[model samples]
Target: MSNPLGGLARRASFIDSVRQEGCGVCIVDAGDFIAREGRISDKNSIQLRIAAEFMLQAMDRLGYAAANVGEGDLVFGDSFLAGIAEGLDVQLVSASVFAGGARPFAPARMFTTAGITIGIAGIAWEGFTPYVAEHSDPGRPMAMAATADAMREGLEEIAGADVKVLLAHAPLSELRILLADIPGYDIAIAGHDTNMEPFAEPELAGATRLVNRGWDGTHAGRLDLTFDRTGALIAVAGSAVLLDAAWPDHPDMLTLHADYLARVAAALRDILAEYPVSPPPTGTRYAGVQSCVTCHPVQWGSWRQTTHALAWQTLVERSRDYDPECFACHTNGFQWTGGFTLYEDTPAMAAVQCESCHGAGADHCDAPLLPYSRPGEAACLRCHVPLHSPEFDYGTYLPKVAHPKAP
Candidate 1:
């Protein structure tokens, strides 16, 4: 996966080719899968299984035969994910997950094809462990030190079996440290670095290659290496592969994704969709002045008269604008890194409008629901007050927000 743009389709094509070529492919996921914006949450086993299956199928759609689950995965709880692992054909390898008493999970798993044994193991950052006891058994989050200790065992197994590669899932900061400390493996795959660019790092322990695949399977790390008849390294693997470009999407996985995603989209559409609001003058929807006219007409009127009307102007082309802490309060619309524009009001006429101070008017426009119109003092305090302070001077803010009375 290279660029996030056109990520899903491109990745599908790339992996499909790999599977067709019969080249043993390893798909490594670093972490943070469940903590995403679109993550589906459910209490039922089937629903949880469906969510996990959806993510797993995406990789399976590509040529990855196995994956090491990560921290964000903990958002769904251990038992549910573990159940998901049980249902999938892929292997779950993580030194950080401990399930004793004939636990269905394995700490590390080896994939063998054509007499070559390549074992993949996983260990998450110390902060990634989740709290839970799933499947009617006692389970505990593997501690960092304990996880490291367990990593040594997994590495030992790799050495004993003479596995050629090591795949891992953990934070980038921790992965760097591990690559330096553990020299038993030939290659290290990294994850949990949302900003990672999927490039190789300087060699560590005299003989290991380390790389990161950008999150959400947008970028895949592709390397070409050589081995002797006995599976000994002849030439080091080179060539960086990001899934952004043209690649094959596996057929089976696509079928699986199609089957599950159809259902997921159907169920989630109602919650996620933002229907057409009689769209405001600028195409952006604000709660409108009407909702709060009775309670705060003074403030609303001042807002109507200000330059803040074109709030979206600040957002034109700024997707990386970071969070809207100050700009959103003093201005209108929002600031995205891609730059802001008043889409609803039209660039020429876009102004903050009366609803800027109130809220999006779509819901309450038909009914003046007091609850949705105003968030009270707390909502205004985010930008008005100091961090971690409970006290806010609404009186001081009121002066700035509303026009001064006639002298």
Candidate 2:
């Protein structure tokens, strides 16, 4: 029901599965269905923007009824949202967010399916100003009102509908507080709570039911509501469906994903060609695994025996060698000092090499005894993060690629 954050393949699978059930279903997003902001290069930013464009296009094709505008979705700014909304059959709703002194999204959207009129209103939290400002163009900025105040006003406009559902892009704690003061909506679906589990117990407030599935499109939330002709709610049930490797990918979605990747790769090539890359700082030049072979032959040989040596090959096999996002973890020194830029430019740094965890090796190569920072937990965390390797543990993994401590 929310937070599909660029997992196009799984989302497509989920959508296909849902469509098979019947036309009585209408898909709605709580929020955050785009690329998130983090440490990124200009190239990474371009890729995210392109990916967001394709995501919007895909959502339109999938037939989403209403999608709440989450903070992460503001990366492209108000104009981009407006542009996509125009081309889409889906209506982007947000009571809290305003652009150019006017609300870019409708405060509420109505959908009629199976003789039930579903009223959907969206409310985004107030702390998203910095994130949007960081990723958006300087010329354009976003504005927001108080979440509770805005949603109160929005509910009035949609009160005529049979079932009222508030898509609050805020935490459960915050939603609970807001729902107390404004008690009109029958149900609320929330996002931005990264801790929620698929089977987690739902929080109930009088007749209202609050539902959420944790972040990152790992699972999808499904809610079925049965209402009488007079708009009185008779029954309501919700569950989270896991979208894992077992789920079949929709043929159309797979085609769309492949096309999107191709376009992103082409765009990246053009951007890289136009923007000249500056050299790494004085002490930050990377030395590939080969540079360490002479000094530490045993360690180098051991590393080759591990999966780290074949990082680039995995990406190559999947045809994701050119993808900046995937390359960050698969290659050495990616987005770091004297790291990988493009595959052709930094072919030697294609795999997870010696300098990936350890500091840049130019200084060490110049002077054998030159002090180099040892790889620590933080270094491992750069790539072995939760989203990439959920089971990665520093203590457990350190022994796998352990080498002699530098004196």
Clashes within 3 Å, all models in order? 55, 0
**What Cα-based lDDT does every candidate model obtain?**
0.52, 0.76
Off by over 4 Å in 2: 1-6, 37-43, 127-141, 194-201, 227-231, 270-283, 393-407
User: TM-scores across all candidates?
Assistant: 0.59, 0.86
How many angstroms is residue 148 displaced in model 1 relative to the true structure, after the best TM-score fit? 1.8
User: How does candidate 1 fare on TM-score?
Assistant: 0.59
Please write out the lDDT profile of model 2 over residues 289-402, one tens digit for every residue: 878888888888788887888999998877777676787688877666677778888898889888877767888898988777676798888777655576687899888878
lDDT of 2 at 111: 90
Candidate 1 C-alpha lDDT tens digits along 102-155: 333566777775466777766665554333232223453333325466567668
For residue 169, model 2's alpha carbon misses the true position, in angstroms, by: 1.7
Measured on C-alpha atoms, candidate 1 has an lDDT of: 0.52
